[model samples]
Target: MNARIRGIFEDAGVRGWMHAVSLDEPEASVELDADAVVPMASVYKLPLLAGFCRLVDLGELDPRERVTLEPSARTAGPTGLSAFADPVTLSLRDLALSMATVSDNASADALLDIVGLRRLAEILESFGLRRTWVRRGTAANLRDLQRRTGVDDPDAALAVLADNDRTDPVGVYEAANASAASARDLTLLLRRLWAGELLSASQTEFVKTTMHRQVFLNRLASGFPHDGVRVAGKTGTFGALRHEAGVVTLPGGAAFAIAVFTHAARGDFRQPRVDAAIGEAARVAVDVLR
Candidate 1:
């Protein structure tokens, strides 16, 4: 199973790590380079959401509290509230929903400001995820990208990333300031969440439901199309990195937490093969545990 999974990544021309563990029996698991640190991209939103939910649970935050954001206040992104031209008012709960469901940069930045990086760090520590963290918010990440590449435009920065001969890819990747995690740590986090160890039962259900509403499905979900199986996933993509982490639940109440992180050999932004490999690799890992 490990060789087959490694072959999927090799065939896709990318470095990959994966871990899948059965929720019904956590001892049943599969892994490959699961402890290697990798860029998490937008996958940080998962922990951010958990932190925000924790605040709500502690009575420290009012989910119904309304905030108005101008168009300029939003982080630069292609989707959701970030793409809007007019000022918008939203409840804190809706902002989190937008962040989780649509990967809304604007909403994420807003929530991060409210939750604060210190609080997020505390949340990860509480969950025993020593290697996972949010170094900075999305806006800071984009600014760092421009600063490091000497390119004011995102497209130009991406072009710099694509030129391996002229640029140090590792330096560029580090400059992105994305969240970081390992497959083992992420999978363990999910397993604990599913086991009701990270959050209360109701809050855990909220997190799972938010993940279930994710609109992006080209990665892990593509591999498991069985009608009886339900996937609740979060996807992250930046530069040559693509990742998806989530729980797949079978009809008989059996579930597995899977995390697949990959970095392509080339910097093409639209690599369907890499995306397919993510799903295929995750499917193989899940099958082994099943």
Candidate 2:
């Protein structure tokens, strides 16, 4: 398993680590410097969503409650709520869907505002995520936006990110303000969710289903066939750092959580090797469980 995973990383020119864990056997797990902290990139959104759900659970916010998106609230890029017709109005449920399904920055920022980052931090503490730090800044979502713009430039793209400093006050964030997570904790989070210990089964199912909509699959999801093997994950990338972490459910109800972080050559965040390493690590978890 290590050899296969190593080959994938070597092929991708990724310099980092991989961790794997199987749900069928709680005591068994794999680590490759899994304790190391790494920037979360957009993977921070999972905690954000979990925090929002906690709010809903507490009756502080209503999932069906309607909210407005002011022009000022309108940040741009792959987000549904942000790019929707100006002054868009939607329920919290819709907004969360937009944020998770597309990694929508506007939806994320709005939710962060509603949920509050400090409270989110507290929630992570309760969940036992020590290194994961999404605190507060600008275009922290830049990796995705940058990739999108480089491939799909527009008249309004560059200026928006250039003004990312406005994101915190205006509701954007830089990667630094976001928290970091280790490969091990990330896998533990996934394993717990799949085992129905992270949240209520319904809540866990919501997260798992929501993550399945991730449109960008060049990383971990690219490693395995989408059929019998299911990869439900969140990805994070900044500069040359590439990270993808989540649960992989294989045939016969076995599941494993794996997180892979890679440092790559400039402009190689999308390299296939890093992605393959993530896949191989997940495959290892499945093998162990079987």
* Top TM-score prediction, candidate number: 1
TM-score per candidate, in order?
Answer: 0.95, 0.80
lDDT of 1 by residue, 1-290 (tens): 78898899999999888888998887888888888778788888888898898888888889899999899778988788999999999999999999999999999999999999998899889889977878887788777777878889866776776665664434656523567888888888888887888787778888999999999888998888887888898888877788999998877887899999988887777889998898888788777878
Off by over 4 Å in 1: 162-170, 175-177
**Candidate 2 wrong stretches, greater than 4 Å:** 1-3, 82-85, 137-177, 268-273
Residue 261's lDDT within candidate 1 is: 91
Task: Give each model's whole-structure lDDT.
Answer: 0.85, 0.68
User: Candidate 2's residue-wise lDDT over 29-109, tens digit each?
Assistant: 766778877767667777787777767777788989988888675655545665677687889877887787777778887
Q: Report the alpha-carbon TM-score of model 2 versus the true structure.
A: 0.80
